[model samples]
Target: MPIVNFAVAVEKGKAHLDAGRPDLAAFLFGQVLEAHPTHPDAVNGMVSVLMQMGRADEAMALLRRGLEANPNHPDMRVNRGALYLMTNDYESAIRTYEGLLAEEPDDPVQLVNLGGAYMGIGRIEDALDCFRRATEVAPDYGGGHLNLGMLRMVLDTEGSAAAAEADFRRALDCDPNLHGAWLNICTLRRRAGDPEGARDAAEMALILAPHLLDYHQNFAECLLALGRRGDARKVLESLLQVNASFLPAELALAQIAVDEDRPAAAIAHLHRGTELRPQDPLIWANLAALLHRQGRIEQADTALDRALTLDPGNAAARMHKGRIQLAGGRLADGLANLAAMYDLPEVAAQSPFGRLEGAEPAWDGGPLAADLPQGGHLVLAPEPDESLTFLMFRFVAAAREKVARITFLDFRGLGPLAGQVPGIDAVAAVGDGADIPCDAIQRLGALPGLLPGALADPGATVPYLTPPPAAAKAWKDRLSALAGIANLPTIGLLWCPEGRRDPGDERALPLQQAERLLQVPNVRFVSLQFGPAQNELDELAQGGLVTRLGQHVDSPSALAGALAAVDLVIAVDGPAADLAGAMGLRAWVLLPHMPEWRWAQKDGAPIWYPTVTAFRQARAGDWESAVAAAARSLERMLGD
Candidate 1:
């Protein structure tokens, strides 16, 4: 065998691979290996290039030949183990790594690979232990800390954020050029509601790895979170320049266009994505949604057909199809699809009891026995959001004629008020499922599909969740004392809702826009807001323009009572809006331009809530028109 400079040849091979010409890299590596058959660098480089080119069998043959020549070769051994991991042969990967560890103990890279194989097999505890050991043996190895940080987040997403972030930062401290550690820190910063910090970390990642598509995407996400739409778009566009077929960058750009209220631009991006990957169902599904929203029914239908054909279980496509059917008066079909939309992994993760996991089979709004051993018991599981749960109560109220007895397996902090709802016969906490009487169980979200006819019957569903009479009286008395003028029409109002809200959260309206409604004549406004939003009413309260229902606003029951006491409830789309709608109260539900499909209008009202009229922002972030319309409605309804 000829003696060649293996060092220079390996460097050239790597350079070729980095230049995106794996074939050239493979040829160079092949030349080096032919001259020096047992050279580990040549074997490893050639193997990597072959794998990149999807020539795994050829790569394996070359690896075996090299290993036979130099049986104890470290790089070749590690490459073989990594190939096993990549091929989903977790057991083989673990064995290979363990065998290697016997020869070279406490090797951080081998330990990290072993941890990955353990993770592939879902042995989370083992994976954690391996990752910890890798860091322990090689504290300066950034990869070990990076792996540990990622695993911690997966272990308990919200709970482990701080610790995971610390690990990521530690990794960056050990190796300043570790782009992956910086990327993880960016994710953690975003989760901690520090998008500025996230953006900074994302910038570090992008600077380190300008060629990495994932880092660019993360940087764009950080920008989006910070409400820098133009900057995010620039990042995503540049990513497309790097890799024209990058689906994630295309999706991100489309979402940014949606945020900017540029439906045409969003559609154009989705169309570009389709051209790049015609078989990708996600792009097709998204295209369908925008087309449907714009009333391009035929185009949307075509998109939906293409999406569903590509992936029959595509939830977004199915949900949009249902929306189209509902809009077209295909009631049952639409309801079923809407039902499917709720049955998503994200929704289930939001609530432990989002769906019934009872021993009894799920009831599909079927006729119940007049006398089950326990009197026709049926457990109603909850939806992810409180607003959705409130809507579920409407469905329960409508279906009261079918089931003899009801037990709501309430989650989502709605437990405090579940028993107070009109049709609920009993209420139980989520974990007390065993104690709850249930002959059969059903998900609250499933009600739409099960009882579409009943839900559609306004008479049956209306006023299904009335605020407690005594609670209402208490709120009314407080308002009467506070207002000084007993006969003035009282209005319950909300701008920002409780929980996570940002500038990009369209469901929340700016308080300044709502201040105009507070100045209406003849009507006294009651503040149905909590936390910092209540502070916005200080000036109005001082001027006697509004009455802040301070303590009552914090309690769910008291909030409902406030709604009952008011002559009208005008609010943004959230729990308050859903509560008013569920109670069949006269209310105005203000909507963003791209509201969820359930808020779609029918005869000037939300389709799900016949009594709640909607005032929609014609474009994103343009709530002024909607606010003005609500003010006029307020004047007509209660103003002098």
Candidate 2:
């Protein structure tokens, strides 16, 4: 071939590079460089192709040869610096860029590259200065503004969020097609509680770069936040079809399945994810969580062990292991694992309550060195679950006897019910933020650990809560109207299987299984189930098994009255059972083979609820046996 054909080869290489065929580009450039060793275009083109192929060492050698041939070639020098940055040789990259800047002091591209090198080496302040200078030198440079905004986001201070938003907007103004800038704006808006704005920004990004996976993922997340879960699921499913090995898409599908109460589907998705990425501890941990929710304790433990083996310091895996052990009646082992979470730096950093800061050491269940201040101690309710509320009531009643001033901070608008508990000096809503001037604050769930022997021997049970007289009378009159139809015993039937998210929990007796209880000769069944389970009630009514009463039983006070009015309450282990125990009402709680820790395995009755009888399933997911035993018990109660 003619030596003049070297320029033709170089031209062909440039065409391949533009067509996104880096391998072909590299081959053509190699031919050109073989003929003309000092050809600048061919050398730079080969280096770019090598870098694209992740052959950084090869790219560096070629760049060195190119710079040796032409000592003043700026493009080859810049490529060399970029190769250093790619290889994570931040110091070398910084020195190279600094040398380039010395020659061309006001080069915006060099400044931006320098900023990236500084960021790679943790010199955040220096990186910010470089980005600022780059933006100032070229006011229309969108990349400079984008990098500046990203750094501000990482800083994450009080006013940094707003500043980041401004920089991102400026980047978009400079270049409307900047997809990265649009994605950042989407995230910032979502974090600021503007889901609609987030959706708009995400849509713009998707339009600009439809093939980008992150844009699709973030758009789906925005849809989820806006309560468009169906839409989110469709988007995620489409993403999975495009790339089945995409871990994020798999995890998102699992989350949607969990939310929709399809544990089987969630498990399937996680199983596929684990198969694809067997070493990912987070995927194994998520699988364990779903198994635990389904009451598969042994399987859940096995999954957690795999996670812990892969990542021993995983706080989420450790926490889950502790809960599983606790559910299996290993209290000491469980508490030890749970307490270790507080000591883990990763866990402490993630806690929304903030790290255990200040001069005062964290109260680790040790005896108080001295009495609390005159203002006494404040007890904050962790959540609004009925069981949690009742447990808090027990702690408050016990603490009031010793502490002079005990204040209860109720966050769930449970002040009305908490006010009913005697010895509470002040029952205030959390939003009130009334300064109680307490010496120390204790989370209500933490009280059990602080009180020695509290779990070992749960002391005498008492009626801690009662329905208001008016509410009780209203329910009584409501039930009296039904008395004329059936003079038999009135039993409140609660057949809710699981919480909203956990649709098919093993602890819940299926309505079909529960219908066997209604077969008992003379008993009136009233539905105590809540939420959007009217369809379930209508099915039971069609089968002549139960009557709906959920409409009248809305508030907690009303629920208490309904429980009080009934002759007996039959329910699974849920809020209804917790309420019955709190009110000291007669109840028969059906338990799964591996019940919650609160329902410790026993023979006759639970110590916590003297009037409640717990019937356990012989095997896991054997609600039929539990239902049969409950049926016999109900029949015997009617005979009595």
Candidate 3:
């Protein structure tokens, strides 16, 4: 009667397991094993549950015990074989599956299971053979088709999209409720850029099982591709409602928040996601990137450290951490980290994104131009305020001795500032004299000079130089004050840069909002901008809420000098913020929802600029919220 009771318990456990309640099934199976010490069914059920929970060692122990008691039990043997696969003990799994295959050669399920073990060990060809054979044995087996399709997806070429698509579709046809097949189909559709098709497939899968988190994430991606961002966000939110622990859903939510220019929300979502999935290297890497953008360098370091702990060999994490260290002026530490990465086999072969080849030094001064001479004298154009170049200079100063071997050449317009600054040899305009080969030329905005038809001839040997602190500071104070107005809160406004075409640039406010800022009591708004929008601002500022400074400031350093006298600087996506950062000036930066990589993924006050604060758009293409935040900060500042 006791043995019969064990049998009944095992039957109930099997039913629960089939229904996907592995925890409940495991509990019941444990009771059966307690009633009958050698109950094969209970032992198998527990092993399966433990394996699903990633407790591979415990599952293996149970399998061994089952084998000791009933060595020839086919189901126990199969379960033990499966447990080996979970532990990545592929050799053992294969041996066990092979032995069982001898006893039940026609068992299609065992064949499919063996295929999975083969795939886990990277034996793609063998796995394909097993799946194909399993399919042949049971023509209607949807799992066999799904497994075969997945293997093909990895090993096949991009050109084989049609084949992969057909296989996935066939699997779905064989078992209409097959979730894996549906997901794969959506993935294939996405790869082909058929966003609508992808969304439809994902929706179909979700209809069958609303609890599939992966389906929700995939559907969100599809919706984003289809330009249905609102719909995608709703789907992600619904997923979080169903399963708060869903890591992928959180990542999707963060992406949506960033899309809407809600960097604060994005940061919060990412933090929760990382906590739930601490072992996920991608999440950690992303969190570090976000923290760094917000200028929280120390926190970024800690996040990266955690990521490396989760995956010691994650090359992306190492590269980013190295860059962050370099940006933070930890020259030796950053360089050492970057150099150490070269020892990693994967990074040594190629960076996670690409080969880590050192950038080639540009040859700006040219004998090729023939009119150029080596070591030609030149003037330097003062570095732009708050530019990437300024950021690089801070790194150089902290690490100067280390980079002493590198040469420094100033551009012609910038020669005066170069003379006034600490380290420099000579300066020349791109067209000042005969083209010359120099060790370096500084400033990225000067990239036009190196273009094909620019003044500097091709093949000239010239290295580009980054900004020094004094040069960066001089530029912001000089240019920002050019608007020629007096008083506290001497606001510097830069709505856009000259020449346009910058994807990151945006119209900071509508004419109505610009008027509102001007109307704000006691705030002196000055236009230090250099763009065609002067006419529009003049029309908008006719009553005296704004002052245009472009005429007074001659160069970036002059602007920097002028900016130093101002109480506040407000800008968006230009060298001005970088200049303000270098000068340690109190500045507010208006960033689009999807900020550049340098700004990181989340919105926060950056660690790179102690005096700078960020205001992000609340949604894509919406500047209303950002302007309001600026207004609030200004009001608070005035009140204080």
Candidate 4:
């Protein structure tokens, strides 16, 4: 053989492989291998070139011939094992690695490859043991520590992150420029609710390995957690340009759109994500939820079915499916779907209520105290949203008969309205409720499912909640104070009155958009819209357009009285709708093209509210149609 520059040839071949020119890499490797067929490095170089070119069968053939000629060739055996793994022949791959480990038991490279083989077959414990042994054999090897750390995360599914963090730290100690370790640390910190730490780690990972798409995705999530939506959006948009079909980048963009109050944009992003990764169940589930919100019930159901078909165990898919079924009146199926969400580890960890002085039995809407010698004291879990708390008050009245006493947990400002609800006992502020000696607790959302036909009582849907006399007097006096307030029929408006509007608030009907309704003759439009949105009211009030009415009412009962003072309430879907429906106040509820599960599949026929009428949008984000319909409804009402 002419003295060949084999080192130069192999180096040049590797450079070609790195440049993604596998054809050129194969030509150079072949030239060297022809002269020295049995040379271990030459054969390995040719095999790598063949594998890179996606000719795995040719690579395996070369490995087989080399191993046959040199039965004790370690390099050929490792190459054969890698080929088996590439072909997804798990049994062959595992046997090959095991045979290699038998010869070189302390080789961290062989040990880690075996661990990966075990992982392919779902033997996670075996994989974890292999990774642990690899680290034990080579304490100073960064690759071993990195593999150990990553494997520990999978093994310790519910354990503390200390072990993984420690291993990752050791990996970094072995090599400070290990981008993989930094990426894992970012993910670990984000999961632990340390967004600040996650962001710092993510920035380092991105700086170290800007080529990796996951670093960008992780960075965006960290930014989102820190309420940096604009920054997150910019990062994700740029990431998409690098790889348009990047699934995680698309999902993160969809979430950013939702945060910015742009549901239409959110839905568009989610739809594109579904197209990019059709088999991804969560994307389909999210799309279903957004569709269900827009009143596209049939389409939402179709998307949900596809999601469930792909992944029956997907928690979000199940929850949204349940909500859709319940909205469609399929109570049993909906409840079954909800069971997973309610049983999630996070939800299960919450101690909703404390043990009362006496025996506290869980009230499942069943007749309590029938068997227990000690009577049942039912303590209902507080609603996170004040509207839900009030909505539950009416139905909870029926539960009073099942238990000796019923105590409503007042967490979200429901303390004031407790007196108005016809129930047995006091309104215990959340913490105090646990000490009241109650035997059992129940989630207010579960009452309908627990007691079949229990909510069918006509009286429950009627005007069950009453405004306090004092609250009603305050609202009436405030209305009387306005000049000519009593002259024309009053219509309460709950649209968002913000100067800089949020596009994501689907229920937000901008005050300016109500110009047509304002044109309705012989009607006094009072501002029932509240919160930061009042700034818009102040701007219009300066020129004698619309005065803020919410500034006058502070409590839920007071808001209820304010609603009662109006002849007809025209508002978007929100707390006002919940109160209006509960009070049986005649109101026109402007609905988004896709409303929430609370309103059910149809707009006009809300089961909980008999007097309220729904004005649904014909297209997504088109409040004009719903508002126009409301204006027409007003014209008709005035004519009547």
State the lDDT of candidate 3 residue by residue for 165-195, as single tens digits.
Answer: 7777888888888887888888888788888
What is the overall TM-score of model 1 with all chains considered together? 0.69
lDDT of 1 at 464: 70
What would the per-residue lDDT of candidate 2 be over residues 1-640, giving only the tens digit for each residue? 5346777888888888865678788888878777788789889999999998799998889888888998788888888899999999999999999999999888988998999999999999999999999899998998889999999999999999999999999998999988989999998998999999999999999988776777889899999999999999999999988878888888898999988878899999999999999999999999998898777778889999999999988888898898777656676577556655655676455432232234233334433323655344544443325664574465556555555565667655566666777767677665523444555555555666666665674425357777777778988888888844357788898866333325556666667777678889777888877666534766553356577788776677777788999999998888778778878888989988767766764455565666788888886678888999999988887899
Q: Lowest-scoring 10 consecutive residues by lDDT in candidate 3?
A: 455-464
* Top lDDT model: 1
Task: Go through the candidates in order and give each one's C-alpha lDDT.
Answer: 0.79, 0.77, 0.65, 0.76
At residue 496, give the lDDT of candidate 1. 75
Candidate 2 has its poorest 10 consecutive residues by lDDT at 352-361
Q: Where does model 3 exceed 4 Å of error?
A: 1-8, 104-106, 210-212, 220-242, 261-271, 274-386, 390-494, 497-573, 576-640
Off by over 4 Å in 2: 1-70, 81-246, 249-280, 294-296, 306-315, 335-384, 392-407, 410-431, 437-439, 459-487, 494-521, 526-558, 589-600, 603-640
> Per-prediction RMSD in angstroms?
6.8, 7.1, 10.8, 7.2
Give the CA lDDT, 0 to 100, for residue 497 in model 2. 34
Question: For model 2, what is the error of residue 340's alpha carbon versus the real structure, in angstroms, after optimal superposition?
Answer: 8.8
Better of 1 and 4 by TM-score: 4
Using all chains and alpha carbons, the TM-scores for the candidates as numbered come to 0.69, 0.66, 0.60, 0.70
Per-model tally of clashing residue pairs? 0, 0, 66, 15
